[model samples]
Target chain A: MNHNLFPGFIGLSAALFAIGAVGVLVRRNPIVVFMCIELMLNAGNLALIAFGRFTHTMDGQVFALIVITVAASEVVVGLALITGVFRSGRGLDVDELSEMRE
Target chain B: MSVIFGLAAAVAVVAALGVVVAQRTLYSALALVANMVALAVLFLTLDAQFLAAVQIIVYAGAVMVLFVFIIALLSPGAQERLHPLEARVLIGGLAAVAFTVVVARLTLNGVSVAASGRFYGRLGPFAPVLVDRHGQVQTLGEQLFTTFLLPFELSSLLLLVAAVGAVYLSRRRRAS
Candidate 1:
Protein backbone atom coordinates (compact mmCIF):
# COMPACT_ATOMS: atom_id res chain seq x y z
CA MET A 1 0.00 0.00 0.00
CA ASN A 2 2.53 2.62 -1.06
CA HIS A 3 0.04 5.11 -2.52
CA ASN A 4 2.16 4.99 -5.67
CA LEU A 5 0.67 1.85 -7.11
CA PHE A 6 -1.89 1.79 -9.97
CA PRO A 7 -2.12 5.59 -10.02
CA GLY A 8 -3.80 6.50 -13.29
CA PHE A 9 -4.30 2.91 -14.44
CA ILE A 10 -7.59 2.67 -12.52
CA GLY A 11 -9.18 5.66 -14.20
CA LEU A 12 -7.67 4.74 -17.56
CA SER A 13 -9.03 1.22 -17.30
CA ALA A 14 -12.47 2.53 -16.43
CA ALA A 15 -12.49 4.81 -19.44
CA LEU A 16 -11.30 2.05 -21.73
CA PHE A 17 -13.93 -0.33 -20.40
CA ALA A 18 -16.62 2.24 -20.97
CA ILE A 19 -15.45 2.91 -24.50
CA GLY A 20 -15.44 -0.77 -25.34
CA ALA A 21 -18.86 -1.31 -23.81
CA VAL A 22 -20.24 1.65 -25.70
CA GLY A 23 -18.82 0.29 -28.93
CA VAL A 24 -20.28 -3.15 -28.35
CA LEU A 25 -23.73 -1.80 -27.59
CA VAL A 26 -23.65 0.62 -30.48
CA ARG A 27 -22.22 -1.58 -33.24
CA ARG A 28 -24.01 -4.22 -35.24
CA ASN A 29 -20.93 -6.05 -36.47
CA PRO A 30 -20.22 -9.32 -34.71
CA ILE A 31 -16.47 -8.98 -35.27
CA VAL A 32 -16.20 -5.42 -33.98
CA VAL A 33 -18.38 -6.20 -31.00
CA PHE A 34 -16.20 -9.21 -30.28
CA MET A 35 -13.17 -6.92 -30.16
CA CYS A 36 -15.03 -4.63 -27.80
CA ILE A 37 -15.79 -7.50 -25.45
CA GLU A 38 -12.12 -8.38 -25.42
CA LEU A 39 -11.37 -4.76 -24.59
CA MET A 40 -13.83 -4.89 -21.70
CA LEU A 41 -12.19 -8.03 -20.29
CA ASN A 42 -8.77 -6.40 -20.44
CA ALA A 43 -10.09 -3.38 -18.58
CA GLY A 44 -11.51 -5.61 -15.87
CA ASN A 45 -8.17 -7.40 -15.65
CA LEU A 46 -6.29 -4.13 -15.24
CA ALA A 47 -8.58 -2.95 -12.42
CA LEU A 48 -8.39 -6.32 -10.70
CA ILE A 49 -4.61 -6.35 -10.68
CA ALA A 50 -4.49 -2.74 -9.52
CA PHE A 51 -6.59 -3.69 -6.50
CA GLY A 52 -4.53 -6.83 -6.03
CA ARG A 53 -1.35 -4.82 -5.67
CA PHE A 54 -2.95 -2.30 -3.33
CA THR A 55 -4.37 -4.92 -0.95
CA HIS A 56 -1.30 -7.18 -1.09
CA THR A 57 -3.56 -9.95 -2.26
CA MET A 58 -2.43 -12.51 -4.84
CA ASP A 59 -6.11 -13.39 -5.25
CA GLY A 60 -6.70 -10.38 -7.51
CA GLN A 61 -3.60 -10.83 -9.65
CA VAL A 62 -4.37 -14.53 -9.94
CA PHE A 63 -7.92 -13.74 -10.98
CA ALA A 64 -6.56 -11.43 -13.65
CA LEU A 65 -4.60 -14.39 -14.99
CA ILE A 66 -7.74 -16.50 -15.06
CA VAL A 67 -9.53 -13.71 -16.90
CA ILE A 68 -6.92 -13.80 -19.64
CA THR A 69 -7.61 -17.45 -20.32
CA VAL A 70 -11.35 -16.94 -20.18
CA ALA A 71 -11.01 -14.07 -22.62
CA ALA A 72 -9.00 -16.12 -25.06
CA SER A 73 -11.61 -18.84 -24.92
CA GLU A 74 -14.33 -16.27 -25.38
CA VAL A 75 -12.70 -14.94 -28.52
CA VAL A 76 -12.33 -18.38 -29.98
CA VAL A 77 -15.90 -19.38 -29.29
CA GLY A 78 -17.38 -16.04 -30.15
CA LEU A 79 -15.51 -15.76 -33.43
CA ALA A 80 -16.30 -19.27 -34.47
CA LEU A 81 -19.94 -18.66 -33.79
CA ILE A 82 -19.76 -15.52 -35.80
CA THR A 83 -18.28 -17.40 -38.68
CA GLY A 84 -20.96 -20.04 -38.32
CA VAL A 85 -23.71 -17.49 -38.37
CA PHE A 86 -22.12 -15.96 -41.42
CA ARG A 87 -22.10 -19.30 -43.22
CA SER A 88 -25.59 -20.18 -42.01
CA GLY A 89 -27.43 -17.00 -42.90
CA ARG A 90 -24.85 -15.52 -45.22
CA GLY A 91 -25.14 -12.31 -43.28
CA LEU A 92 -22.07 -10.75 -41.61
CA ASP A 93 -23.80 -8.16 -39.45
CA VAL A 94 -24.72 -9.01 -35.86
CA ASP A 95 -28.09 -7.33 -35.99
CA GLU A 96 -29.04 -10.18 -38.28
CA LEU A 97 -27.45 -12.88 -36.12
CA SER A 98 -30.46 -13.33 -33.92
CA GLU A 99 -33.71 -14.83 -35.22
CA MET A 100 -35.86 -13.94 -32.19
CA ARG A 101 -37.64 -10.61 -31.79
CA GLU A 102 -37.58 -10.56 -28.03
CA MET B 1 4.20 12.13 -8.15
CA SER B 2 3.09 12.65 -11.75
CA VAL B 3 5.71 11.94 -14.41
CA ILE B 4 5.20 8.31 -15.45
CA PHE B 5 1.60 8.04 -14.33
CA GLY B 6 0.73 11.17 -16.25
CA LEU B 7 2.42 9.91 -19.41
CA ALA B 8 0.62 6.59 -19.14
CA ALA B 9 -2.67 8.38 -18.63
CA ALA B 10 -2.02 10.51 -21.69
CA VAL B 11 -1.33 7.43 -23.79
CA ALA B 12 -4.52 5.81 -22.50
CA VAL B 13 -6.58 8.82 -23.47
CA VAL B 14 -5.05 9.04 -26.94
CA ALA B 15 -5.57 5.34 -27.60
CA ALA B 16 -9.12 5.53 -26.31
CA LEU B 17 -9.78 8.39 -28.68
CA GLY B 18 -8.52 6.18 -31.47
CA VAL B 19 -11.01 3.54 -30.43
CA VAL B 20 -13.82 6.05 -30.60
CA VAL B 21 -12.93 8.01 -33.72
CA ALA B 22 -11.08 5.61 -35.98
CA GLN B 23 -13.22 5.14 -39.04
CA ARG B 24 -11.55 1.92 -39.99
CA THR B 25 -12.22 -1.17 -37.90
CA LEU B 26 -8.67 -2.45 -38.32
CA TYR B 27 -7.25 0.84 -37.14
CA SER B 28 -9.47 0.67 -34.10
CA ALA B 29 -8.19 -2.82 -33.32
CA LEU B 30 -4.59 -1.70 -33.45
CA ALA B 31 -5.37 1.29 -31.28
CA LEU B 32 -6.99 -0.98 -28.73
CA VAL B 33 -3.81 -3.05 -28.67
CA ALA B 34 -1.84 0.09 -27.98
CA ASN B 35 -4.12 0.80 -25.06
CA MET B 36 -3.60 -2.67 -23.65
CA VAL B 37 0.16 -2.43 -23.93
CA ALA B 38 0.17 0.95 -22.26
CA LEU B 39 -1.92 -0.49 -19.46
CA ALA B 40 0.50 -3.40 -19.00
CA VAL B 41 3.41 -0.97 -18.73
CA LEU B 42 1.51 0.97 -16.05
CA PHE B 43 1.12 -2.29 -14.14
CA LEU B 44 4.86 -2.70 -14.32
CA THR B 45 5.38 0.82 -12.99
CA LEU B 46 3.03 -0.08 -10.14
CA ASP B 47 5.46 -2.84 -9.07
CA ALA B 48 3.00 -5.62 -9.77
CA GLN B 49 5.48 -7.73 -11.70
CA PHE B 50 3.22 -10.78 -11.66
CA LEU B 51 0.28 -8.79 -12.90
CA ALA B 52 2.43 -7.05 -15.47
CA ALA B 53 3.77 -10.35 -16.69
CA VAL B 54 0.26 -11.74 -16.87
CA GLN B 55 -0.89 -8.64 -18.75
CA ILE B 56 1.83 -8.93 -21.34
CA ILE B 57 1.68 -12.69 -21.74
CA VAL B 58 -2.07 -13.16 -21.63
CA TYR B 59 -3.92 -10.02 -22.62
CA ALA B 60 -1.24 -8.61 -24.88
CA GLY B 61 0.11 -11.80 -26.39
CA ALA B 62 -2.64 -14.40 -26.34
CA VAL B 63 -6.01 -12.68 -26.18
CA MET B 64 -4.93 -9.96 -28.57
CA VAL B 65 -3.72 -12.47 -31.11
CA LEU B 66 -7.14 -14.08 -31.01
CA PHE B 67 -8.79 -10.72 -31.53
CA VAL B 68 -6.56 -9.80 -34.44
CA PHE B 69 -7.14 -13.19 -35.94
CA ILE B 70 -10.88 -12.65 -35.79
CA ILE B 71 -10.54 -9.23 -37.30
CA ALA B 72 -8.52 -10.68 -40.12
CA LEU B 73 -11.02 -13.45 -40.59
CA LEU B 74 -13.84 -10.97 -40.68
CA SER B 75 -12.03 -8.97 -43.38
CA PRO B 76 -12.75 -5.41 -42.24
CA GLY B 77 -12.45 -4.10 -45.78
CA ALA B 78 -15.34 -6.22 -46.90
CA GLN B 79 -17.61 -4.66 -44.32
CA GLU B 80 -19.39 -1.38 -45.02
CA ARG B 81 -19.24 1.59 -42.69
CA LEU B 82 -22.11 2.44 -40.38
CA HIS B 83 -23.53 5.97 -40.26
CA PRO B 84 -21.97 8.37 -37.77
CA LEU B 85 -25.08 9.13 -35.73
CA GLU B 86 -27.22 6.73 -33.73
CA ALA B 87 -29.33 6.60 -30.56
CA ARG B 88 -26.69 4.48 -28.80
CA VAL B 89 -24.28 7.40 -29.04
CA LEU B 90 -26.72 9.56 -27.14
CA ILE B 91 -26.84 7.13 -24.21
CA GLY B 92 -23.10 6.46 -24.37
CA GLY B 93 -22.33 10.17 -24.38
CA LEU B 94 -24.39 10.69 -21.24
CA ALA B 95 -22.70 7.76 -19.52
CA ALA B 96 -19.28 9.09 -20.46
CA VAL B 97 -20.07 12.51 -19.06
CA ALA B 98 -21.24 10.92 -15.80
CA PHE B 99 -18.07 8.83 -15.61
CA THR B 100 -15.88 11.88 -16.06
CA VAL B 101 -17.66 13.71 -13.24
CA VAL B 102 -17.36 10.74 -10.87
CA VAL B 103 -13.62 10.35 -11.49
CA ALA B 104 -13.08 14.08 -11.09
CA ARG B 105 -15.02 13.94 -7.82
CA LEU B 106 -12.89 11.05 -6.47
CA THR B 107 -9.69 12.99 -7.09
CA LEU B 108 -11.17 16.20 -5.71
CA ASN B 109 -12.36 14.42 -2.54
CA GLY B 110 -8.79 13.19 -1.83
CA VAL B 111 -9.86 9.58 -1.64
CA SER B 112 -6.45 8.08 -2.14
CA VAL B 113 -5.82 4.35 -2.59
CA ALA B 114 -2.45 2.78 -1.81
CA ALA B 115 -0.05 2.57 -4.73
CA SER B 116 2.40 -0.28 -4.19
CA GLY B 117 2.20 -3.28 -6.49
CA ARG B 118 4.38 -5.34 -4.21
CA PHE B 119 2.91 -7.29 -1.34
CA TYR B 120 3.90 -6.15 2.17
CA GLY B 121 3.14 -9.04 4.53
CA ARG B 122 -0.46 -7.87 4.91
CA LEU B 123 -2.27 -10.90 3.45
CA GLY B 124 -1.00 -13.53 5.86
CA PRO B 125 1.46 -16.03 4.35
CA PHE B 126 0.51 -15.32 0.75
CA ALA B 127 2.25 -11.98 0.50
CA PRO B 128 5.46 -12.98 2.24
CA VAL B 129 5.45 -16.25 0.40
CA LEU B 130 5.69 -14.43 -2.92
CA VAL B 131 7.82 -11.57 -1.69
CA ASP B 132 10.61 -11.75 1.00
CA ARG B 133 12.73 -13.49 -1.67
CA HIS B 134 13.01 -14.22 -5.36
CA GLY B 135 12.02 -17.89 -5.35
CA GLN B 136 8.22 -18.25 -5.06
CA VAL B 137 7.37 -20.93 -7.56
CA GLN B 138 7.02 -23.68 -4.96
CA THR B 139 4.54 -21.86 -2.71
CA LEU B 140 2.65 -20.30 -5.58
CA GLY B 141 2.52 -23.62 -7.32
CA GLU B 142 1.29 -25.31 -4.18
CA GLN B 143 -1.45 -22.81 -3.45
CA LEU B 144 -2.63 -22.80 -7.03
CA PHE B 145 -2.94 -26.57 -7.15
CA THR B 146 -4.19 -27.34 -3.65
CA THR B 147 -6.06 -24.57 -1.79
CA PHE B 148 -7.41 -22.86 -4.89
CA LEU B 149 -7.73 -25.95 -7.05
CA LEU B 150 -11.50 -25.89 -7.48
CA PRO B 151 -11.75 -22.49 -9.18
CA PHE B 152 -8.70 -23.37 -11.23
CA GLU B 153 -10.35 -26.52 -12.49
CA LEU B 154 -13.60 -24.70 -13.15
CA SER B 155 -11.81 -22.09 -15.19
CA SER B 156 -10.21 -24.76 -17.35
CA LEU B 157 -13.61 -26.31 -17.94
CA LEU B 158 -14.93 -22.94 -18.99
CA LEU B 159 -12.11 -22.52 -21.48
CA LEU B 160 -12.69 -25.99 -22.87
CA VAL B 161 -16.41 -25.35 -23.22
CA ALA B 162 -15.72 -22.08 -24.95
CA ALA B 163 -13.31 -23.76 -27.32
CA VAL B 164 -15.72 -26.54 -28.26
CA GLY B 165 -18.59 -24.18 -28.58
CA ALA B 166 -16.52 -21.99 -30.89
CA VAL B 167 -15.66 -24.95 -33.07
CA TYR B 168 -19.23 -26.11 -33.28
CA LEU B 169 -20.55 -22.68 -34.07
CA SER B 170 -17.93 -22.05 -36.73
CA ARG B 171 -18.54 -25.34 -38.43
CA ARG B 172 -19.63 -25.16 -42.05
CA ARG B 173 -23.27 -25.24 -42.96
CA ARG B 174 -24.55 -28.37 -44.71
CA ALA B 175 -26.26 -27.80 -48.02
CA SER B 176 -30.02 -28.03 -48.04
Candidate 2:
Protein backbone atom coordinates (compact mmCIF):
# COMPACT_ATOMS: atom_id res chain seq x y z
CA MET A 1 0.00 0.00 0.00
CA ASN A 2 1.32 3.40 -1.02
CA HIS A 3 -0.90 5.37 1.28
CA ASN A 4 0.50 8.09 3.54
CA LEU A 5 -0.65 7.11 6.99
CA PHE A 6 2.10 8.89 8.85
CA PRO A 7 -0.08 11.67 10.22
CA GLY A 8 -2.73 9.28 11.40
CA PHE A 9 -0.20 7.09 13.14
CA ILE A 10 1.30 10.13 14.86
CA GLY A 11 -2.14 11.23 16.01
CA LEU A 12 -2.73 7.79 17.45
CA SER A 13 0.58 7.95 19.25
CA ALA A 14 -0.36 11.29 20.75
CA ALA A 15 -3.70 9.98 21.93
CA LEU A 16 -2.08 6.97 23.55
CA PHE A 17 0.50 9.15 25.26
CA ALA A 18 -2.26 11.33 26.63
CA ILE A 19 -4.18 8.36 27.98
CA GLY A 20 -1.05 7.02 29.61
CA ALA A 21 -0.39 10.40 31.19
CA VAL A 22 -3.85 10.46 32.67
CA GLY A 23 -3.42 6.96 34.01
CA VAL A 24 -0.14 7.86 35.61
CA LEU A 25 -1.65 10.94 37.17
CA VAL A 26 -4.85 9.42 38.54
CA ARG A 27 -4.04 5.79 39.32
CA ARG A 28 -3.16 4.95 42.90
CA ASN A 29 -1.81 1.45 42.38
CA PRO A 30 1.90 1.50 41.63
CA ILE A 31 1.63 -1.42 39.25
CA VAL A 32 -1.10 0.29 37.27
CA VAL A 33 0.96 3.44 37.20
CA PHE A 34 3.91 1.44 35.89
CA MET A 35 1.72 0.00 33.18
CA CYS A 36 0.75 3.48 32.16
CA ILE A 37 4.43 4.37 31.91
CA GLU A 38 4.90 1.41 29.61
CA LEU A 39 1.98 2.66 27.55
CA MET A 40 3.64 6.01 27.15
CA LEU A 41 6.93 4.40 26.16
CA ASN A 42 5.14 2.26 23.59
CA ALA A 43 3.53 5.37 22.18
CA GLY A 44 6.99 6.85 21.77
CA ASN A 45 8.19 3.72 20.01
CA LEU A 46 5.28 3.91 17.61
CA ALA A 47 6.17 7.46 16.72
CA LEU A 48 9.80 6.55 16.24
CA ILE A 49 8.99 3.70 13.90
CA ALA A 50 6.49 5.81 12.00
CA PHE A 51 9.12 8.49 11.51
CA GLY A 52 11.55 5.85 10.33
CA ARG A 53 9.12 4.59 7.74
CA PHE A 54 8.30 8.08 6.58
CA THR A 55 11.93 9.10 6.19
CA HIS A 56 13.24 5.83 4.79
CA THR A 57 15.80 5.51 7.60
CA MET A 58 16.69 2.75 10.03
CA ASP A 59 17.88 5.12 12.76
CA GLY A 60 14.39 5.39 14.16
CA GLN A 61 14.07 1.63 14.37
CA VAL A 62 17.44 1.33 16.08
CA PHE A 63 16.50 4.05 18.54
CA ALA A 64 13.24 2.31 19.25
CA LEU A 65 15.13 -0.90 19.97
CA ILE A 66 17.33 0.89 22.44
CA VAL A 67 14.24 2.42 24.01
CA ILE A 68 12.68 -1.00 24.44
CA THR A 69 15.83 -2.21 26.14
CA VAL A 70 15.83 0.74 28.53
CA ALA A 71 12.17 0.27 29.26
CA ALA A 72 12.70 -3.38 30.15
CA SER A 73 15.49 -2.52 32.54
CA GLU A 74 13.35 0.20 34.10
CA VAL A 75 10.52 -2.25 34.64
CA VAL A 76 12.81 -4.73 36.36
CA VAL A 77 14.16 -2.23 38.85
CA GLY A 78 10.81 -0.51 39.38
CA LEU A 79 8.92 -3.73 40.12
CA ALA A 80 11.63 -4.85 42.48
CA LEU A 81 11.31 -1.57 44.37
CA ILE A 82 7.57 -1.97 44.51
CA THR A 83 7.93 -5.51 45.78
CA GLY A 84 10.36 -4.39 48.41
CA VAL A 85 8.06 -1.62 49.56
CA PHE A 86 5.13 -4.01 49.78
CA ARG A 87 7.20 -6.54 51.69
CA SER A 88 8.10 -3.81 54.17
CA GLY A 89 4.42 -3.59 55.17
CA ARG A 90 3.71 -0.35 53.40
CA GLY A 91 0.57 0.06 51.32
CA LEU A 92 0.79 0.09 47.51
CA ASP A 93 -0.93 3.40 47.04
CA VAL A 94 1.45 5.95 45.50
CA ASP A 95 -0.23 8.86 47.21
CA GLU A 96 0.39 7.25 50.56
CA LEU A 97 4.15 6.95 50.00
CA SER A 98 4.88 10.52 50.82
CA GLU A 99 7.79 10.25 53.17
CA MET A 100 9.85 12.69 51.15
CA ARG A 101 7.04 15.24 50.97
CA GLU A 102 7.21 15.95 54.68
CA MET B 1 -4.74 -0.86 4.64
CA SER B 2 -6.32 2.24 6.06
CA VAL B 3 -9.21 0.18 7.33
CA ILE B 4 -6.91 -2.21 9.13
CA PHE B 5 -4.91 0.67 10.55
CA GLY B 6 -8.07 2.32 11.79
CA LEU B 7 -9.26 -0.87 13.41
CA ALA B 8 -5.94 -1.42 15.15
CA ALA B 9 -5.79 2.18 16.28
CA ALA B 10 -9.28 1.99 17.73
CA VAL B 11 -8.44 -1.20 19.55
CA ALA B 12 -5.28 0.39 20.91
CA VAL B 13 -7.12 3.47 22.18
CA VAL B 14 -9.88 1.47 23.84
CA ALA B 15 -7.46 -0.95 25.40
CA ALA B 16 -5.46 1.96 26.75
CA LEU B 17 -8.61 3.36 28.27
CA GLY B 18 -9.31 -0.04 29.74
CA VAL B 19 -5.88 -0.08 31.37
CA VAL B 20 -6.53 3.30 32.90
CA VAL B 21 -10.08 2.62 34.11
CA ALA B 22 -10.04 -1.05 35.18
CA GLN B 23 -10.63 -1.30 38.91
CA ARG B 24 -8.72 -4.52 39.36
CA THR B 25 -4.97 -4.53 38.86
CA LEU B 26 -5.08 -7.87 37.06
CA TYR B 27 -7.68 -6.50 34.67
CA SER B 28 -5.45 -3.50 34.05
CA ALA B 29 -2.57 -5.82 33.19
CA LEU B 30 -4.74 -7.75 30.76
CA ALA B 31 -5.90 -4.55 29.14
CA LEU B 32 -2.27 -3.51 28.71
CA VAL B 33 -1.60 -6.79 26.96
CA ALA B 34 -4.40 -6.09 24.54
CA ASN B 35 -3.00 -2.63 23.96
CA MET B 36 0.44 -4.06 23.23
CA VAL B 37 -0.97 -6.47 20.68
CA ALA B 38 -2.84 -3.67 18.98
CA LEU B 39 0.39 -1.65 18.86
CA ALA B 40 2.18 -4.57 17.27
CA VAL B 41 -0.42 -4.58 14.55
CA LEU B 42 0.15 -0.86 14.08
CA PHE B 43 3.89 -1.47 13.79
CA LEU B 44 3.23 -4.00 11.08
CA THR B 45 1.06 -1.54 9.21
CA LEU B 46 3.88 0.98 9.41
CA ASP B 47 6.16 -1.48 7.57
CA ALA B 48 8.26 -2.10 10.66
CA GLN B 49 8.07 -5.88 10.53
CA PHE B 50 11.03 -6.39 12.84
CA LEU B 51 9.71 -3.86 15.35
CA ALA B 52 6.34 -5.58 15.28
CA ALA B 53 7.97 -8.88 16.20
CA VAL B 54 10.06 -7.28 18.93
CA GLN B 55 7.00 -5.48 20.29
CA ILE B 56 5.21 -8.78 20.69
CA ILE B 57 8.17 -10.75 22.01
CA VAL B 58 9.55 -8.21 24.43
CA TYR B 59 6.45 -6.24 25.37
CA ALA B 60 3.49 -8.55 25.00
CA GLY B 61 5.52 -11.66 25.74
CA ALA B 62 8.27 -11.08 28.28
CA VAL B 63 7.36 -7.75 29.85
CA MET B 64 3.67 -8.49 30.21
CA VAL B 65 4.36 -11.91 31.65
CA LEU B 66 6.57 -10.25 34.23
CA PHE B 67 3.83 -7.73 35.00
CA VAL B 68 1.22 -10.42 35.44
CA PHE B 69 3.56 -12.50 37.53
CA ILE B 70 4.25 -9.61 39.86
CA ILE B 71 0.55 -8.87 40.12
CA ALA B 72 -0.09 -12.47 40.98
CA LEU B 73 2.71 -12.53 43.51
CA LEU B 74 1.61 -9.37 45.27
CA SER B 75 -2.11 -9.71 44.50
CA PRO B 76 -2.53 -6.02 45.15
CA GLY B 77 -6.25 -5.71 45.59
CA ALA B 78 -8.53 -3.46 43.59
CA GLN B 79 -7.54 0.17 43.79
CA GLU B 80 -9.61 2.43 46.02
CA ARG B 81 -12.20 4.24 43.96
CA LEU B 82 -11.74 7.84 42.91
CA HIS B 83 -14.81 9.81 42.01
CA PRO B 84 -15.13 11.08 38.46
CA LEU B 85 -15.28 14.64 39.70
CA GLU B 86 -12.47 14.27 42.19
CA ALA B 87 -9.99 17.14 42.20
CA ARG B 88 -7.12 14.84 41.30
CA VAL B 89 -8.99 13.36 38.37
CA LEU B 90 -10.06 16.73 37.09
CA ILE B 91 -6.56 18.14 37.31
CA GLY B 92 -5.00 15.11 35.69
CA GLY B 93 -7.58 15.13 32.91
CA LEU B 94 -6.95 18.76 32.20
CA ALA B 95 -3.18 18.32 32.22
CA ALA B 96 -3.43 15.35 29.87
CA VAL B 97 -5.54 17.37 27.47
CA ALA B 98 -3.10 20.25 27.46
CA PHE B 99 -0.16 17.91 26.97
CA THR B 100 -1.88 16.16 24.07
CA VAL B 101 -2.72 19.39 22.34
CA VAL B 102 0.83 20.70 22.63
CA VAL B 103 2.50 17.50 21.53
CA ALA B 104 0.08 16.90 18.69
CA ARG B 105 0.63 20.38 17.35
CA LEU B 106 4.41 20.02 17.45
CA THR B 107 4.39 16.60 15.83
CA LEU B 108 1.94 17.66 13.14
CA ASN B 109 4.00 20.69 12.28
CA GLY B 110 7.26 18.73 12.15
CA VAL B 111 5.76 15.99 10.03
CA SER B 112 4.26 18.47 7.63
CA VAL B 113 7.56 20.27 7.26
CA ALA B 114 9.40 17.00 6.63
CA ALA B 115 6.73 15.88 4.19
CA SER B 116 6.78 19.16 2.28
CA GLY B 117 10.49 18.85 1.45
CA ARG B 118 11.52 21.72 3.73
CA PHE B 119 13.43 19.56 6.20
CA TYR B 120 16.89 18.88 4.81
CA GLY B 121 18.20 16.10 7.01
CA ARG B 122 20.02 13.67 4.80
CA LEU B 123 17.88 10.58 4.33
CA GLY B 124 19.57 7.32 5.23
CA PRO B 125 20.59 4.78 2.64
CA PHE B 126 18.00 2.25 3.71
CA ALA B 127 15.17 3.34 1.47
CA PRO B 128 12.06 1.21 1.23
CA VAL B 129 13.33 -0.53 -1.89
CA LEU B 130 16.64 -1.41 -0.22
CA VAL B 131 14.91 -2.44 2.99
CA ASP B 132 12.52 -4.77 1.18
CA ARG B 133 15.34 -6.22 -0.88
CA HIS B 134 17.70 -6.74 2.06
CA GLY B 135 14.95 -7.89 4.43
CA GLN B 136 13.77 -5.71 7.26
CA VAL B 137 15.46 -7.61 10.07
CA GLN B 138 18.75 -7.91 8.27
CA THR B 139 18.91 -4.25 7.40
CA LEU B 140 17.94 -3.16 10.87
CA GLY B 141 20.41 -5.57 12.41
CA GLU B 142 23.21 -4.28 10.22
CA GLN B 143 22.62 -0.70 11.24
CA LEU B 144 22.19 -1.61 14.88
CA PHE B 145 25.42 -3.53 15.00
CA THR B 146 27.37 -1.05 12.94
CA THR B 147 26.29 2.56 13.43
CA PHE B 148 24.68 1.98 16.83
CA LEU B 149 27.07 -0.61 18.21
CA LEU B 150 28.17 1.38 21.26
CA PRO B 151 24.66 2.06 22.53
CA PHE B 152 23.75 -1.53 21.83
CA GLU B 153 26.59 -2.87 23.99
CA LEU B 154 25.92 -0.31 26.72
CA SER B 155 22.31 -1.42 26.87
CA SER B 156 23.49 -4.92 27.68
CA LEU B 157 25.55 -3.57 30.54
CA LEU B 158 22.57 -1.57 31.73
CA LEU B 159 20.43 -4.70 31.75
CA LEU B 160 23.07 -6.48 33.78
CA VAL B 161 23.05 -3.71 36.36
CA ALA B 162 19.27 -3.75 36.50
CA ALA B 163 19.25 -7.50 37.07
CA VAL B 164 21.73 -7.25 39.91
CA GLY B 165 19.82 -4.38 41.44
CA ALA B 166 16.56 -6.26 41.29
CA VAL B 167 18.07 -9.32 42.89
CA TYR B 168 19.56 -7.25 45.66
CA LEU B 169 16.40 -5.25 46.22
CA SER B 170 14.11 -8.26 46.35
CA ARG B 171 16.40 -10.45 48.47
CA ARG B 172 15.30 -11.13 52.04
CA ARG B 173 16.61 -8.79 54.70
CA ARG B 174 18.85 -10.50 57.26
CA ALA B 175 18.27 -9.86 60.96
CA SER B 176 20.39 -6.95 62.06
All candidates: CA RMSD (Å) = 3.8, 1.9
Going through the candidates in order, their DockQ values are 0.52, 0.72
Tell me the spans in candidate 2 whose CA falls farther than 4 Å from its real position: A1-3, B110-115, B119-123
Positional deviation of B109 in candidate 2, in angstroms?
Answer: 3.6
**Steric overlap count per candidate:** 3, 0
Candidate 2: Cα lDDT at B23: 89
List fnat, each candidate.
0.45, 0.82
Best by TM-score: 2
Per-residue CA lDDT of model 2 for B63-154, tens digit only, reads 99999999999998756676789998889878877877887778768766766676524556877789889999999899989999999999
Deviation of model 1 at B39, angstroms: 1.6
Give Cα distance to truth, residue A102, candidate 1, Å. Answer: 5.3
The iRMS of the candidates, in order, is: 3.3, 1.9
| Structure candidate 2, residue pairs in collision | none
Q: Candidate 1, what DockQ?
A: 0.52
- Report the lDDT tens digits of candidate 2 across residue range A1-102: 443566688888988999999999889899999999999999999999988887778999999999999999999999999999999999899989999999
Q: TM-score for each prediction? A: 0.82, 0.94
